[model samples]
Target: MASVLWFRRDLRINDNPLLSEFRQDIVLPVFIFDTQILNKLSKDDKRVSFIFYSVMKLKNDLKAIGLDLAIFYGEPLEVFEKISSICHIDEILACGDNDFYAKSRDEKISQSYKLISFNDAFLLPASYGLKKDGTPYRVFTPFYKSVLPFVEILSQNQYKIKSAKLVDFDYKSIQLESFGFEKADISHIPYIDKPMELLNDFKPYFDMYKDLRDDISKKPYTSGLGIHLRFGTIGIRECIRELILYQKEGIDTSEFIRELIWREFWNMLLIHFPKSEFDNFYAVDIKWENDKDKFHSWCEGKTGVPIIDAAMRELNATGFMHNRLRMIVSSFLTKDLLIDWRWGERYFAMKLLDYEASSNIGSWQWASSTGADGVPYFRVFNPYLQTKKFDKDGVYIKRWVSEYKDIPSGKLYDENYLLMYGDSFYKKPIVVHKVASERFVRAYKDGMIK
Candidate 1:
């Protein structure tokens, strides 16, 4: 009987536990273009394009080993049923996904097949990293401290491919049009062929990451590997192993590793409190203004605040935003605009190429001050001050907001100077920062009291 390797988030050939499990057996590797998820996306979603490219790459690699990837476009259950009808599948092996939809889908699939899943997405399995009472940790500091000591780095597996009984079915790649999506122009997007190449490129900047990560002007200061991690093109353990190697070479990896741990923190939170995906973890009974016009302005990068506008424009054009800007823009949306964080979260879910549900929701809740360990409600990010501090020379602002290219750096942060540009040059600031901050603080305090 042949085994079925069901590829979900884990797309790469190396560091794949599911692929390693059936190294010597007849493994039918399959990737389903899930309609349940795809139906919600636009026709030109870059994330879909990236995924399609990755699956094609995986198919080519399998062909080199005298194997073929079985690609399908439909619901997971229906796709699996078709696979079962075609061959005598012994069991289904896959890397487990912890999102709400995945959990539900896997539960239904398990009822029909012997689905064996592994924790390939995170460094620590969902079961590990717990509190003293065997419950999940809501706070991140304690969770990180507790799990740090128990972290074990695994060596990369080298699988021995063996010929086995081949199924008599056509194994070919599926067309994007067949799944109701068109070819997205992703030429501007940076994609790595191998995970090791990405790690190698980041080596030169690894030491300075702690110092320059917060500087928005230095655009690529942080390792640009979020999409790879989100899609599991690179395994978390493999990344940790490289970090360990870097530490041995006398470079401090604590800050970079902490960022990785933050990803795990979100994963743990989502696994324990799945409701946090859609609802506020710590519910506050405050009425959101939900200004439709304000949201449209923010989405269109017409917030009038240079930094916020730059960040939003960057996200709109590239499907990627700088981390510091993400925090600032999110703060501006929830604090200044007084819009519900869910609206901003939903927009990001649709736009971000590297959007992971757990991290995106976690970050939104944190920015909105509604999560278990979120920032204080009154702590609003002042967009002007943030620009002066991070993008002092206005390089990032000029790069994204072309209208402000000729403006002097000093004048960019000055409201009076910006007034000279008038509405034609840029839209006036939607809400006065100080006034909005006071309003939000007062409302938040009253809600907490109630």
Candidate 2:
């Protein structure tokens, strides 16, 4: 039977269920640059360039194995239909995607062809962990505990690719520009081609991760694996294996693994509650100020709060923000600026090279106190205090906000001082932290009452 190996998020050849489990007589490996999604993205989107690079690398790797990856530029349905017209396709195998657009697209394609999907993107399927009554767990800790046992079982790699004849097809090479995206400068980004290298680089710092993971100033702070994991350049099982290996070496990896489980929790939450992408999960009726100028300032990293400015500038420049910085900036946007979390979430979607819909949406909701197991509305992060805590030496701030280099680090932590200094070099604080925090909490309480 002729089967098409449709590559989506899972871009790698190693540890891929789609490649290892296939037993068809004839197989066509394919990757599509979905124009439907691409059209909505900016021409200079860093993710497009990264994906293009990864896809090309995958193509070459497949060719080395006496197989070729066919590249297509169109919607999945139309592309599949085109492939179906040429050959008698028995089935198309791909890694399952739980995002709304992916689900809808796959459903449409399944109507016309036999489409089979595997859970290669994540360690476990979204439906794995549930409460006693069969309802999905809303809280994370219980969910993490429930799924923790299965890590061993899931980690066990057991698969071999059966010999299959490569389907002969006229494949075409496509450039990043052909898809209407400018070639992005991805050299500064880590592990675009080699995920294992990044993993190796992260090992030395893994010991300090428990204590310093939240410190934005610590270079190589968190495992720089988010982008690799997001695109399936590295498999979740492979990462789990590394963690387990560390655990066997008597290195405490539980805290790091917990963060991975949090990623899982967010994915599961998104699968069950897709509407939370746009609406509040808990239905808090927050009447967001959504000041256009304030949001623009926040996006441009001109929030007058040193930490917020630094983090925002980092994200805008590099398509990456530290986890702690994400939390701080998100709080500043949602609570401090009284802007809609959706606004900030959407902006991240546009910029972050590691942007995963589930994680991004889940995190934004959490920051805004509109999600299950989210931070309380009363717990607004004081940007100044956060700076004093995470970036005490002002290393991160100085690195990103170059204008603040000559200024004393202490002044950055003082909102009144920055405000008094005025708009000479940097922007003044758009909203006072004390006043904004109280107003936000009051608004949230009012939302609950209504």
Candidate 2, 283-402: lDDT as tens digits: 789889989999999999887888998889999899998898899999999999899999999999999989999999999999999988986679999999999998888998999999
TM-score of every prediction relative to native: 0.95, 0.97
Clashing pairs in 2: none
**So what's the TM-score on candidate 2?**
0.97
Residues 1-450, candidate 1: write the lDDT tens digits: 678888888887776777667643667888888999998999899989989988898889877767778898889999988887878778898888788889999999999988898888887777765787999998889998988875643334333444554455789668888877898887765555665688867787888889889987865787778888888888787788888888899877888988888998998899989999888788685678999999999998997889888999989988999899999999999888888999999999999988988899999999988886787787899888898899889998999888887778887788666655637676677777889988888767766734
RMSD, every candidate, angstroms: 2.1, 1.3
Q: Model 2: residues >4 Å from true position, as ranges? A: none
